[model samples]
Target chain A: MIAPLLHVTGLSKRFGGFVALNDVSLQVAPGERLGLIGPNGSGKSTLVNCMSGTLVNDRGRVQFDGRVLDGLPPHRRAYLGLARSFQLPRPFSSLSVRDNMRIPLLYTAAVRAGRQRAENEIRERTEELLRVVGLIDKADARPIDLTQVDMRKLELARAMAADPKLLIADEAMAGLSNAEVDDILGLLMRLNAQGISIILIEHIMKAVMAFSQRLVVLVSGNKIADGAPSEVIRNDHVVRAYLGQ
Target chain B: MTSATAVENPGRKVQAQIGTPMFAALATGVAVLFYVALALIGNEYLYFSGYVVLQFVVMATAWNILGGYCGYVNFGSAAFFAMGAYSTVCIYSIGTEYARSGVGKILGAIPPPVLVPLLIAFAGIIAGLVGLGMGYLTLRLRGVFFSIATLALSVVLQTLVVNWDFVGGSRGAYVIRPNEFPLLPGGFIAYLFVLMLLLVVVALTLARGIERSRLGFGFTAIRDDELAAEAAGVPTLRLKLIATTVSGALMGMAGASFPYYIGYLQPNSAFGLEYAVNAIAMPMVGGTQSWVGPLVGALLLGSFQQWATVTISSVLNLLIVGLVLIFFVIVAPNGIVGLVREWRRKRVLRKAVRP
Candidate 1:
């Protein structure tokens, strides 16, 4: 098998006495699509937070693209081609949507290119990303003016601006119509097709089943199952703990 | 894809871009015009009051670099200002001591024209280092916590200044003002006014330049949501530290001429609460979002305070600020700049719909 793009080992996080994630280890191969799902009060977000450097893990290590991401800040991780969208859309409200896209491009993509990107190049790239997310018309609009789904789209597009090798979308579709979920799923599929690995964390089963090649289940700070999507769903432990068989 | 073709560079069409150098030239032209007007008026009282107003322009602009751009409210304006004032005092005291000594007469002979600019630069460097140090210590605390720490910092610095005796301490220090300036017609007060006018030009140009650059975008991102900014690859801490240092340096430069202007430098006067309040209020009252806001706010409010001090009572200045601030908070929550933006946006919408 090819080497994994992301590897988390024995990751543990605690808030006071309560363990948020404990001994959680996982791997995603290059160009793989992995689904991370868990019940309420489970460690899914805690794990993402640790991996993204929003919150430090009490113990264990996170490796991404052949580099150890132990104490690196989130911006440093983005420099290394790891990017995540917040569970809630947190666009720079004061900025227009296109300007929002410019943040990651200016900071991460430009730095990665190792040369200054011309203003026209940055503007064109921004427009292209906004178009991909179907937000081209709303480029001049403020984030506050966008609909819920469009806000999510803007969030994803902003993350995509970094040209990340690995994208961890934390619940990119939470409260969406069936149509909106499919729209996001299609966007994610398009991004994945461009040689970008994706770890999709979602509660929506239909989208997850349709999107993830592999599935990982978390329950009460522990990974209960990790395997092919179909087999993982059929696992007795996952069914009992999460699928509610 | 068809819609992409339809849009056809919508962002470019909307943006009326001005290069930084062009903007700076225009701003300097406007400032030079104002300086000429003031010099032609040739009133020393006008220069004195104008110097106070222009000084606020620098302080308010400085405060906005961190407070308005990055959403970090620094309540230690007076502390930084006093740091600059005391730095000037230190230099002045040293010069006086050297003049009194037989062997060191040559060192004391350094002329005011050369000496004043050096003192301003020195004060800026000293205050900038202090700002960097303070930001490193306190930037981790967000929102109100950061503000509280800044307030505490001012108090601590004030106590330190009151106790330290070398630069006159609680007893205060005197800086003998030169009666004449060689180059200009209106003497030393006019020289101070001209220096402050140039400083305003520098501060405004710097503020406007930052507002349009990548650094400005990072600052706006931090102001909007710091967590998202960091995740988006913007270095929030470094950007914030830069803001603090720049902000502190400008405030220090504003104060560098204070001892010379006032002829007396007391800890209480230099570390006046008025400096801190006016610095914050000017930005908030004018609008914190753009470079234009602080300048507008400082000029309007600073001029009014000066007028009130002359026509009514000096004691009423703070009371007027409080009243005006409350009125603006209720009536124009986004400040004057925001109000203008909202109006302009509506007008555009109206025009678009008319066709």
Candidate 2:
């Protein structure tokens, strides 16, 4: 197979004596949809944080798009086209919806493109992203005005504004309705079709099974299974560790 | 795609909101008009009072850039202000020694008006460098810890000044202003007022520039949620450094002129708690959110303080600030600008419902 877009090898994280992520390794190919699922406290979020450079692993290496991200901070990682959305929508409350997108677009995408985008070009891109997420009419509104599902969509759009090579979406549809989950799933599929690799970390099994081409299961900071969604879900170990409930 | 085309260029529109050239012209005109009115009135008290208020305008504007925009509360503003005030002391001693040794021809030859701007710029640079150092050292602490470090910094600076005898130790040093007048007929105080008016214009321009620029966007992101801002690709540390340096520099510029205005400088008055408290309170009262907030807060609260100093006791000046600060914090957490925005928002909502 071709070189993976993201490669986390022998990653381990410790919170005092408790191992949050222990020797966990995973990979995602270009244009691939990978689902990362685990029980609560199973280190799914910890793994995402390590890969996104929010939390540095105690011992391991995160290689994204050919660069070792050991010493790189989150913004530097983002500049290299690694984008993430928080489990909670963390929009700049002082800024309008459009400026929220502009921060990532201006800093990450423009820096990666190595050119100064025209003022109009940024506006067009921001509006287009808003339109895609069904937030075009609320472009001028603040994040405080957004509904829960809209805030999640804004989070995704903000990440998409980075025009990343790989997107690590941490629980993008955690509390959404089934219809809203479908909305985000369709959006993620469209993003994948446009050639961006994505790691969807979700608790909802149906959404996970519907979207992931490959599924990786973690049990207590360790990867229990990694393969095709159907095969991984049916695995005896994954069933015992996670799916038995 | 068609909807995207229909949307106006938001970036260009936001830039247009600031009206850069128009703002410059209007601000310049207003400053000139203000000084002209003071000159025509020919009242020394008016100029003196106006100078103090204008100084607060600069201080408040500077403080808000870091405290309001970047969400870094600096409780050591007096340290930077004192640094600027002490810069003049340093220059004075150097010039004095040169003249005493009969080798100060170059220093004495430059007119005081020309020298004042040079001194202000030098003071600003010194304060800015200190700000950069303090930010590098303490900004990593986060929230109240950072503020505590700043307060400790003030005490450290004050102790150093108290011990240093060159600037008169704890006794205070006298700054002798030249009797000659070059730019204005009203001599030293009037000249200082004009210099301060210029500083006000500089401070306003800078604060507004940051408010509308990409830097402001990064600052707000840091303020909102620093972790998310980092993930959003904002270099938070670098932007915070810029804000602190600029804020400290302007406060220092105001302080550099303090000795000439007061004719005497001491550690207590220069590094007093009043400067720090007033600088912060003005922005909090007017609104910490934008450039206009600090201006309004300074003019209103500063003039009120000046009036109280003349009418009531000097001790009551801080009392007024404490009351106003408490009122704003409890009633309108967003300050005066917030109140105005809330009022406007309600009016719009009411109108929409009526239709």
Candidate 3:
């Protein structure tokens, strides 16, 4: 079998006396779409933070693309093609939307390519990403000026600018209209089609079911289910802990 | 292909902008003209006051590197400035000791022209290392906590200086100025002014260069949101350390000539509260967003303080600074550059709507 692109072995995290994630281990195959679902305060964001190097797991190791990622900082993880969007959109408020997009291109993508991208090239790529997210018109607008939906789009687009091998999108579709939900789902689907592995963490079950071939559920910091989405959602523990059926 | 063409068309229309080298050249020309104009005035008092004002320009610009660009407030500007001043004192004291012992004449033999530059370089390195050390210890604490830590750092450094007797400790050390400068047209004061003028040029050029570089973008990103910046692949801690080192080094270079400027270096004067206060106030009053902000702020505020000292009383100088700072904070929080930018933005918007 092919080695997993991302490997987490017996991962654990705690905050003071409270356990946030308890010995959780997971894997994502190359180019796979995995949905991560958890009830509120079930360690979904905490797990993402640990995986992205924003938070250090108390135990276990995270290996990504054949390198151990135990003590690397978030920027180093980003350099190694691991990227995530904050659950709540955290845009660089002072920068114009275009400049915001240009940041990752300047720092991550260009560094990965081992050369400074030409100014014209950076501009072209920024506009292209902005166009993909349907935010070209608001390219020069500050983050404060963007509507909620556009802000979310900007968050995802900024993550995309890193050109990551795996994109863990944390609640990228929250608080959007059905049409807007479909808009983001379509974008994610297009990205997956380009062979970028994605972990879609969302509460929108319908979108998750449609987008994810496999599913992982975290309940009170414990992974109770991980399997095909059709079978995992119907699991007794998942239904009792999360689905409430 | 058509859409690509469309995008390329507008991108190509951007006017050619002035690069850093051109900006540096223009600034150097302007600085020379200012120096010549001051010399033509033929007033030694102007050079003396001008030196103080230019010193503020350097300090304000240095403070803005960490405080304004990176959003890390440094309340210990005086500590770094004093470090530079005291480094010179230590060297002078050691040279006097060496001269008395008849061990070597190398330190005493170095002329002022060569000696001042050497002292400036030495002070910059020493203060930069301290800044790095301080940043490593304190940069993890963000917001007001980081600022308070810097204030504490100032007090600790001042205590160390007060107790170190080799450089005269609490009493102070006397640095007798030579009657004349070797190559310079003016006296020692004039020589000091010219050195400060060159330092201003270097500081401004360096600040402007950083503002336009990729590093500048990273700094602004960290300033805006450090976590987000890190996630965007910026090494936030590394960048902050760089800012601290550069800022501290520049402030140190500004203070290296202080002993010569005053001819008497006292702990109270070297670690004065005025240095810290003026460093912060000048940037805030001028606008902290760009290099121009600190330069303008320093010149305006420094000149006013000089004028007030001469025309009015020196005691009221701090009071005037305090009042002006309060007025700007209330009326124009972004400072003069920000105000100008806001005005110009409104003008452009009006024109666009009219057409």
The regions of model 2 sitting more than 4 angstroms off are: A243-245, B1-18, B98-109
Q: Give the clashing residue pairs of candidate 3, or none.
A: none
Please provide, for model 1 over B194-221, each residue's C-alpha lDDT reduced to its tens digit, 9 standing for 90 to 100. Answer: 8888899899989987887778888989
lDDT of 3 at A14: 98
lDDT digits (tens) for residues A120-192 of candidate 3: 7888899999999899999989899998889999999999999999999999999999999999999999999
Please tell me which predicted candidate would have the highest DockQ against the true structure: 1
TM-scores for candidates 1 onward, in order: 0.96, 0.95, 0.96
* Sort by DockQ, top down from the best: 1, 2, 3
Per-residue C-alpha lDDT of model 2 across residues A1-69, encoded as one tens digit per residue:
999989999999999999999898888898899999999999999999999888988998999888899
Residues B1-355, model 3: lDDT tens digits: 4343333222212434556666678888999999899888888899899999999999999999999999999999999999999999998887787775553367887887789989999999999999999999999999999999999999999999999999889999998788697666678889889989999999998998787667888888999999999999999999999999999999999999999999999999999988999999999999998999999999999999999998999989998899999999999999999999899989999999998
The fraction of correct interface contacts reproduced by each prediction comes to 0.89, 0.82, 0.67
